[model samples]
Target: MSLIKFFVLAQLKVEQFIKETEGASGIEYAIIAAMVAVIIIGFSSSIQNGISAIFTKIQAALPAASS
Candidate 1:
């Protein structure tokens, strides 16, 4: 019947759409990762400076040697 054929065609289209979307998911994740990487890279110098300051403070808090 034509109704059965239409239903089959609709199911096939839905399946194809799902498959295409599945493939796109990887690309979406990769793009998000890349954006995060860029943000980290941009802030790397500030992060490094903060870490360095923390270590310096820690060192300064220690007792001085009697040398």
Candidate 2:
């Protein structure tokens, strides 16, 4: 009976340990932050390209000033 009780307590402890979410939250947040960084980097490159194209067109449209 005592041996059975020990095994049961051990099993419960293992289950409780497995169910813990405290340490996992940090990992989840890190993954989310990494994803956000990747998205921002991708968007910034496209935005920079678009702005550069617009400036190039504007520069081409305006005539050069005399020195």
Candidate 3:
């Protein structure tokens, strides 16, 4: 193929790819979901630790049972 023809074909392909948005939106949603998942995972560990400490404090506050 001639150089000009090759460049024209390449440009057309690029324009067509840019015009397609379905895959772009899906990729964006996947990225957002991944970030949200990471945030949830990070918060879960902290929340678990906080809940454990609260339980420990509650146990310490309780009076001992009589023998």
Candidate 4:
């Protein structure tokens, strides 16, 4: 095709992309998922530490254990 036609088509595609809002929601969902993952990881780390402490305390209560 002609260069003018190519440019016109590109302009139309750019305009359509700019006017579309579908991608915005996807980004928002991605951000929400990232935040949720961060929260889960943060809580899980603390939970793991707490569980480890409980196991250590239980271990200490046992007799004939290594010093």
lDDT of 4 at 18: 96
TM-score, every prediction: 0.63, 0.52, 0.74, 0.57
Give candidate 1 misplaced runs (Cα > 4 Å): 1-19, 64-67
Q: Residue pairs in steric clash, candidate 1? A: none
lDDT of 1: 0.90
Task: Find the candidate with the highest lDDT and give its number.
Answer: 4
lDDT of 4: 0.93
Model 4 agreement with the true structure over 1-67: per-residue lDDT tens digits: 9999999999999999999998899999999999999999989988999999999998887764654
lDDT (C-alpha) at residue 57 in model 2: 83
lDDT of 2 by residue, 1-67 (tens): 6999999999999999999999998999999999999999989989999999999987877766422
What digit string (tens of lDDT, one per residue) describes model 1 on residues 1-67?
6999999999999988877765688999999999999999999999999999999987887755433
Q: What lDDT would each prediction earn against the true structure? A: 0.90, 0.92, 0.92, 0.93
lDDT of 3 by residue, 2-65 (tens): 9999999999999999899888889999999999999999899899999999999878777554
Alpha carbon deviation, residue 51, candidate 3 (Å): 1.1
Per-residue lDDT for 61 in model 4? 78
Q: How would you order the candidates by TM-score, starting with the best?
A: 3, 1, 4, 2
What's the CA error at residue 49 for candidate 2, in Å?
0.3
Q: lDDT-based ranking, best first?
A: 4, 2, 3, 1
Taking all chains together, the TM-score of candidate 4 against the true structure is 0.57
